[model samples]
Target: MAPTESNKRLALAIIDFLGSSLKDGTLTADDAESIEIAQSCIADTFKVDPTDEAAVKEAVGGQSLASIYSVYEKLRSKSTPQAGSASTEQSQTDKPKTGAPTAESDKFKSEGNALMSRKDYNGAIAQYTKALEIAPGNPIYLSNRAAAFSASSQHEKAAEDAELAVSVDSKYSKAWSRLGLARFDMGDYHAAKEAYEKGIEAEGNGGSDAMKRGLETSSRKIEEASRGTEPPSEELDSAPGASRGGGGMPDLSALAGMLGGGGGGGGMPDLGSMMSNPMFANMAQNLMGNPDMLNNLMGNPRLRQMAENFGQGGGMPDMSSLMSDPNIADMARNMMGGGAGGAGGAGQGGQGGQGQ
Candidate 1:
């Protein structure tokens, strides 16, 4: 007797389960037996041999039962051909069509991140630029590019890119941080402080400690600059053998040496020797003589704190009281030909005390 429609559907379901198990390498002995029993109820349920590799390969041909069922269902939905009509055959096509460009953009973004991790800032910038070109207005891509720009020392461009990133997504803390640093380098301390503060506000209490510290430091510099002291200079002459006096130009190699050479020995200086050096003593005297000098040299908070600590030590003369002493001040001015001389020199007052 011919099989009923329900029986054929049952046979197909069993074939699908068996094929899936075989493809996934999870077919048990019981499942194999069930497939065999189900196949016996239908003449052409599945042609694949359960154990023979060549027969399975030839019969299955890498096609899942679902694909076969889909085609079968499509064929089943069509009307029967008329008698004596020309022969008709169905052709099945299963080619996967191309999708949208998101995959490519994602690929470029991943490559950019990898380059960034390796410190290849220029390569990272190029990759991120490509990603942005593919999907413009992506906040993450814009922010990543800004980081690369900042790493490359393109501070102005970095600031612009960071601004764009934050405009795209105001909650991007990293972009705000980059913008703050760039603005600070450009001498816009107030704007830098504001950017950092806004970032902290947006990020809540969990914001970065580094950003908070940076904001504080910049704010201090701004306050100090506004106190009617000397205007900022670009000199580098405070260090021995430096040419530009009192200008705050940084020497990278000298700083590196101060930080300890690449070999990483005990890189710190001998503070005891430095304290005992006459040159350092002269520097201290000079620093005290000109209060405005402190504004420039004290830009580094740690160094300023150290200088203040030194000033507070016992036996250090009170600068304000010394300045108020007319006899001492007049004698000091005369001794160095109208310049402020050392405590006791020829223009002559009695030697006050060792503390003086």
Candidate 2:
């Protein structure tokens, strides 16, 4: 008789089981190579391709072989009255009915952890499900399952589990990290960044290295998506402007904008707002403290012309001339880049200059 689809599916499942075992270190390297040879032979005999995920899914009804085996184990454990079943039943009766981490749940969680270590994501998920049955709202169980779900490429489920874990225990840093990773995988960079930020806040002591790295990556993604350019390395730091004091040069374009500096528009720019702006205030402070920068600005021909005209009582001399100066324009461009890069790093006291 010709090999049926059922026969091919069985072979595929066995192949998957062997691969999972190999990943979990249940099989030695030589055993794995032998198993690989056996798998090829099985594939040839059954005319089945284990790599055909669609066929495998269809054959197994969308569940991994490990998941199906887990179900079988549960059913078998219940049906077959083994010698240890009486003791197991007694232990279950002795545990509390409410709250998390019953003996049974812990056992399941340990199994899940083992499966996770072996890279058996579906198997781990099944074990975690069993754990969650005993302790539905347990953050650790939810978080572990979320990790398994993420490993298995079920990002939406991972996010859901991570969110539930955090909701149950807001202080859980791992849950928050998992949530950030899930959100990032979904391309929600803003949400990922917020999650990482919350995770850091929950951690209190500057957060874990993993959480910090996640935050930095998400921040970079946000900057790239919004600004269409690479973000400055310092901007990834928690406080962008804390180290770079107000000594940095001011945004020249902003100063010009405040003094009616752009093209065509003749009326004076909002000097009141300009005075209130953190960038302009920093610029004025820097110029006052750094005579060299001020001299450099004044030495530019266009700025010299404007200053000369203004000195002669020509009120509000055309700032276009000042802005058009190559030296001034170059300074403005550099300052503008810095301002934009650190805009999000502006502290409560407005230490960082706003992008013009």
TM-score of each: 0.37, 0.39
Judge candidate 1 against the unseen true structure and give its global Cα lDDT, from 0 to 1. Answer: 0.58
Residue 202 of model 1: what lDDT? 63
Q: Pick by lDDT: which candidate is best? A: 2
Which regions in candidate 2 have their CA more than 4 angstroms from the true location?
A: 1-99, 229-356
Tell me the tens digit of each residue's lDDT in model 1 across 1-356. 76665554444555555657766778776677766666554436433334444433334333344544543443334224445644234322321111123677779989999999999999999998887665565667777888888888888888877776665556778878888888888789998898888678667886789889879978997998887487667765455322223353333233223323234334334544443667644544544444333333223333333334443542334566654655445443432334455333312333222124
Clashes of each: 2, 0
Clashing pairs in 1: 235-247, 237-244
Cα error of candidate 1 at position 65, Å: 59
Give model 1's TM-score versus the native structure. 0.37
RMSD of each: 25.8, 19.2
User: Once superposed on the true structure, which residue ranges of model 1 sit more than 4 Å away at CA?
Assistant: 1-101, 227-356
